[model samples]
Target chain A: MSPAPTRRWWAAALAVTLVGLVAGAGVALSGRALLVVTTTRLPVALAVGGLALGAAVLGVGALRARRAAALAVALAGAEDAGRADERARHRRFLARLDHELKNPVTAIRAAAAGLPPGDDPAAVRAHATLDAQAGRLAHLVADLRKLAELETQPIEQEDVDVAQVVRDAVDDVCAQAAAGGRPAPAVRITLPTVPWPLPHVRGDVDLLYLAVVNLVGNAVKFSPPGTPVEVRGSDEDGAVVVEVADSGPGIPDDEVGVVFDELARGRDARGTPGSGLGLALVRVVAERHGGRATLRSRVGHGTVVRLLLPAGAAR
Target chain B: MRDPAHVLLVDDEQAILDGLAPFLERSGLRVSTAGDGAQALTAHAAQPADILVCDVLMPRLDGRSLVRRLRADGDWTPVVLLTQVGESYERSAALEEGADDYLNKPFDPQELLARVRAVLRRAVPGQPSLAAASTLVSGDLQVDRAARRVLLAGVPVALTPRASLLLDYLMTHPGELLTRERLLSALWGFESMVTTRAVDHRIAEIRRALGDDPAAPRFVETVPHAGYRFCGPVTRGVPTSGPRT
Candidate 1:
């Protein structure tokens, strides 16, 4: 029923037919010999039968060679198609990068042009606008660099304390607030106080720290002041887990799935400032540590983000 | 009313410092400026400001290191960080480093002023301390830690020692996602033979006492494979008479 076996059967049948024709000629010559015909006819019939047998074998060999050539062509075509797909993906990435960079650059240029040639408050405001736009552009570049590094760099795995990482991330956010001259949001870290020691996870400390910092920082950005942002750590399902919860406006139900996409921001985060690489980086860091990053949020209530990493050997 | 708080603003960029300095000054805060982290430290030493407003990334030192160094030295001056990279990771890192708050770059100046006031209000002297608070209230649920009792809508809810401890912990740390394993380790010592299932059972018991449905949990929401979170707009309440366990 299959095409390949059917073709083979047809080739075998053709060879049989050629053999049959030669045999028929031989039979006819034998009959003539018996009926007093000359011995020359018998020799001619035997020579024809030998030629036919050789031709049938050659035809079968040719059929097999053709099938092998077609198979090789098909395999080559599939490989070529895979390469094309990869190239297309690369092109798409480059195009997205170009588009992301252009927006901020254009804004910066416009702000620069608006700067007046005078010592006035308006000029100062214009300069500030330019500075902010330039900063935005710079941040985009930094995020891209981090993404590239995450993709290409080899992870240095070691025993890392999830609690310590959480503490350091909180510290980083506080420092940013102090440096920026903004009031730091109240961040509450809930660690087991009675337990003398905290559980450790296996991961690159620096990358994990960055990932946690991103989660907490996002909570602060979306939440209102006076409401506390909570960071907590615990062991769950044989893994060391850290969670950041905020009393901020949460992501919509529909948009929750896409928040992990590179450069994806929530629909409610339209006016908020971000490059949208934070969650993406968290996912990358978690996966690299043989873990995962997950989020749950209810609109207007709050959002909770968790980073779960494999538990390391006890120290 | 107390005098307007003195705020020291630190940033690497002259333009940012220049722009933000006048804005704070206009908002009626005594503002000082520093170029980098080292300079911010020196400036803080000479005459300490009520609050520090610093940029996260700078040439001589970063914001996190500066705050850490200050905190390590036992300086408790309230600190805030100004971040261009407004990721949650950076914000949490700042907080861990001893920053009181942070605002993303390109923020409204008025918003920054409001945050400064809010932090100062919380830092005011003789405030009710979270650690010392004996009664914790979230919605209609109340837990009296010292008395070891829980009340839902003014009705007494009997709980086991472990369940009471769990409830107290949850009430004290509202809005925190506490994992079942954490509950197990904390309530029962790290070496306790109890499984995570025990924690689940205890939670179920506590929820039943509070009349919270597991399917649509109001007090303790299950986080699937992760753990549980006490959803709360928690408030501290004055201790009241309750039957002790």
Candidate 2:
């Protein structure tokens, strides 16, 4: 099907033809002996033998070259596909950024246009709206920056107390809820009791704390008010595991895989106040610390997020 | 008539300081303003406010440092922190530095007012009325801290001192996740080398004494990987004569 293989075929045919002609010429030049051989058809037999030998050598070389060329094309195709995939990911990232930015900018613009030149209450209200939208935009940008940092920054490894980290996360979640005017959801923490020792994990404490906070906060955000969010810690298979479980509407099975993707939100979380970077950040932080973040959920039950970090030696 | 509770609002942003001051004043609290933590300290020294509402990030000094400085000087002025949204780490850090409470920025003025009032009530001396109830009653389980007794179905349960203390703490902070470390530090103090396992032993003992099932816990719920929580709705019960703190 390709030109190189076709050219090789043509060259093999030419070699066979040339070899047969030469053998025939040599037999003819031998005069009466050649004429006797030709009469007995022995000269034709030698010509056929020479053509067969020539075709075999050239055909082998052609086949090898054809195989090599096919391999080269396949390799190039794979490289092209990889490049295309990278490009598509970049495009998607930009599109998501644009989509996130557009909302607050549009709101700010609309509010600004509605602003009147007065110290009236309506003017103050508009100013507040503009300020709030600007804050939203700032928060989105900040989350994006933090996510970028998490991806690129080298993590600081130190022995961290898992129980202490969980406490800090719970405290933060409560504070955030109270700030948002929502009654603080009751967060219950269960630590592995004695016989089961509390395991120290090796990671950046601040980053790990942030990841836990994000998990707990997400659980709280998705759940209805008064539903208890539970955080539990244990060591399993040489890894320190912290699980944050929420009695919220669970993520659908089809949407579970992409929950760790940047800007990916569940259908049930449409009106929720989040930048959709929380889970992605958690996954990044866990992975950077030589650990992993995972989620388990059932639609009607609840969602449980597990953050596992490599267990460090007891300090 | 006593003076209205005074609040000192500190933030680097003039717009925020301006935006919040009037709303707080409208909520019936006397408000003072400071541009940053340093100014807040100076203002507090000049005339102490009933409570301090400070931003976490600001010029001259930050909210955490401000609270730390105030606390170091034995100034236990109930302080509330204002932090950026999603900065939960900051909120906890501020709390560790002795801040009474915190609110995330772009907050509803109403929430701020509520926190201000709540913190004032807690910080004010001789305000035992705002303290948690002395006795906790959940269904058949009754924990009376003043009496140092736990009763199930009106029958007294014999509990060791350690078990009694653990139960009292859990009952006092109903619905709160009390971690093993917290329990250890609270019960055994910082010098105790007792591992979290000891806390579990005490909890088990208390659970047994109370006849609480771990699998389907009625009163003490095990929040897997965190700690124990009193899951039942707690109510104030009439105190009986017993040991008093």
Candidate 3:
């Protein structure tokens, strides 16, 4: 069906014709002697043998070429599809950004309208209102920026202090936990006591931090107040694995893959407020780190998200 | 206590400061405002403030960063954050950074006031944890926080963590109008933007576990807009008809 295969078919046809001519010429040139020494079956046999051999060699070459071309086309199509998906994801991200931005703008407007301010009840209420709305907007922008950085850049691999990163992440979210009005979810951080001083792996620490933040935050977010969110790290099959597990409603077995799509909230998470980009962002960051994220969950149990980063590209 | 709670409010917008400054002051609290986190930090350090009320979004310093920077310097002040409709992601970041509480935009002034006061109370030396342990008792239903167990008519009822916590909070405040904010803060923390319907969904799960009829309404009474109430006459201790005692 392909052009290369068709060309090969054409070549085979030409070869067959050439062999037929040569065989005919031989028969004619030896006409009298050939007739005397050979029966009619001899000429026919010679012609058939020559043609079949020519066809077989060309056909094999055509088949191989066809297979290779098919593979190339498939890969091309996949890349195209991925590009389209990326574009679509970007659009969704922008839409989310718009929605997130609107609130603060609305608040700022309201706050300003009531200003020039002293200690009026109206002014005080406005101040608090503006503070809260602006806060929401800042978070949205930060997440958006993270997405952009990941898309436009590549991580530089270097010796990263895994233990230090973990400590910083915990410290980062500790205050957030307290501010959210729930007792800080107990964080059980378990890592090798020894500073493994893992091989320098190429990665962007900031991006990885964002990924860590998202995972830890989600663990705390989904869990009930006072529940523990655990962060565990270990070496698995030569890769450094980090896992964040929560004692909240786990993803359904069937929806595990669906949870990593941009703006794709889980079935049970429908009405809950989520960026929907959390898992998607995590997935991207994991892959960028030369690793991937896998989720294991039981319906009534809990969800554990594991990020596997290759230990400094195998020596 | 704590100098009657001096509050430092930070936001890029002046209108909000204009409106909320007076309301907070009238509520027996002194208020200060900064247009951004940098200014806030400066104002906060000029004179020690009891609390930091901050916006997550700003020109230079964001709420999460403000908290992060503050914590980096070993400065711990209670923070209450404000979020928008889809900014649940920020809620976690804000909390992770050490913010004390968060309220969504278009929030009722009274609700905001309540949240601020609640955060302040918890931040105060002697006040109980914002999510202080409390038991809810309704007819045939008893939720014990200390034991993390529930009973229906003297019978122990099995509940998922979320369900047990939800029922426990409801049962503890029998007659009080438990606002959604309070419930979310008590259960998932203010970082979670749990929908009212989700609350109903969990309540349904609770009722199913209790083997109670929603139409007839035995234990948890659904109070539209205001939150749930424990209407069932409950007695604490021992299982009578719920799960295996």
Candidate 4:
């Protein structure tokens, strides 16, 4: 890797060539030179002795280098295998947890859906609570499973139109918000036109879909009903940048740094219904696609979450 | 005047069976339950159910294999697989294996019931399931989806690639009201930022190629303030004889 080692190799090659020439000349000059003079001039015994010593030293050096190289490869392989095993164990755990939870959730949901609307107010409230909580619990399990799968799965790459992804995310957020018994946020999608269109980002469309949905969903969830959730898209320095801006209570300065962390929740997000893993998913998706997700928020003002990704050409 | 539709509900969990069986019965369906895929197969052998609702991850013979086995034996029963995993590959793989449709688990019973009803409505006796059918015929219009070719009145109709894709999606969905957002996502993945006009542009292209009238349309119909739907009845696979020009 270094020039010094290359230079050393060249020098060693020259030394070997010179030694070969000198040995050949000695054999040719044997009949011409006097035997006593030739003996006085560096004896054949000393030359053979030096050559044997050099060969032994070089052999030991080569053997040590080979052993070190093998050891490094083995350590790297073990580390990778250990990581893969850990991922598999995690997947199995999630699968078991999902199965164990899914059956009961389905049962509870069915029971609630089947419950006839009675005149009793308390029973109706209890039914509503049970149904809502069951749905939330199911959502939590799904989120956990997706996060685990994302860690182990290889991401797909295709030319993804950012405009389409943005629209899909907004629609998903609105539908989810409506399902949660809240007014759907009015989303204003802003993208370039006429001069330059939004660039396509080559990545897993589904993963990008997931990432954007989480971003806009989180923004809509934290914001009050009827407030605006604005999405902006543009091409900057050969990368596509999408920003979700929401008029909501912003995170505290101390909590801002950790918003993208796994299972991290800010003080402003305490009462919100979420899995607290959306931002982490966003960050991971962006990083995997050779991009990044960043946030800029002001207390009591608003928050802006930006997902930047390298632009990809036609697939 | 008609008999209640029969549904074969299969799951490994007993509690799931207890919870869903009665609910389905209450929904006016003649629900027969199976403990696992093997049991479902045996039950079907005894008396074939109108439709099968199977859980994908049963211990003895998984849903995919069950569907595969049934399909290999030349059975054309409509099967709807219920999967727990969220992988698109698994769902598509099941579809490719000749399953009619698949719904993710943890879904509402009402949703499952709706999907079952829809699949039943599409099911035709002695006909190949929708998944196995590559050609669709409706009167003079016949499209071979695998060949990506459209023929009207026994004559080839040239269509843009986008129009062809839109037609394929519409033909497959048939009566389903496909919104512009869904169409955009399906066709262009342009779900946001761009207006719904992009879908209209492609729909116009399709209508032009098919010689369909927006008013009293024979093939594609526009639903006011909603979406578009394929109006005519679609028979799965190619007709035995060519359509008369």
Whole-model lDDT per candidate? 0.70, 0.71, 0.66, 0.76
Error of 1 at A34 (Å): 44
lDDT tens per residue, model 3, B71-148? 777776777777531123432343356565656543445566776776665464433222232344555566654456
For candidate 2, write residues A186-305 as lDDT tens digits: 899999878866788876665677688889888888888888889999988898999999999999999999999878888989888677878887887887887889999999889999
Query: Model 3, residue B32: what's the lDDT?
Result: 88
Q: Which ten contiguous residues of candidate 1 chain B have the minimum total lDDT?
A: B186-195
Query: Whose lDDT is higher: candidate 2's or candidate 3's?
Result: 2
lDDT of 4 by residue, B1-245 (tens): 88888999898877777777777888888989898889999999998998999988899888888888888888878888876322445424644677776555576677678778877888787566655666878888887755656888878887755576678667766887777855764454322323465578668878888889998799999999889998888877664343322
Per-model TM-score on C-alpha atoms: 0.38, 0.40, 0.44, 0.66
Two-chain DockQ for model 2: 0.02
Q: How far does residue B210 in candidate 2 sit from its true spot (Å)?
A: 48
Q: Which candidate gets the maximum lDDT versus the true structure?
A: 4
Candidate 2 per-residue lDDT over residues B109-153, each given as its tens digit: 554676677567545452221113456688988776545677787
What is the per-residue lDDT of model 4 for residues A1-315, given as tens digits with 9 covering 90 to 100?
224554677689899999999987987778665344344446777888899999989976985696677778888899999977975786698779877887788777767776665779998898789888877775566566566666656565566888998887787777766867877688899989858889888877656877888888777877777889899998889989999999999988999998987678887687775677789888878877888999999999889999999899322
* Model 2 stretches with alpha carbons more than 4 Å out: A1-117, A120-122, A178-181, A313-315, B1-245
**Of 1 and 2, which scores higher on TM-score?**
2
Residue A199's lDDT within candidate 4 is 83
Clash number by candidate, in order? 50, 12, 63, 4
Task: Order the candidates by lDDT, highest first.
Answer: 4, 2, 1, 3
Interface Cα RMSD in Å, per prediction: 15.6, 14.0, 9.5, 6.7
- In Å, residue A194's CA in model 4 sits off its true spot by 9.4
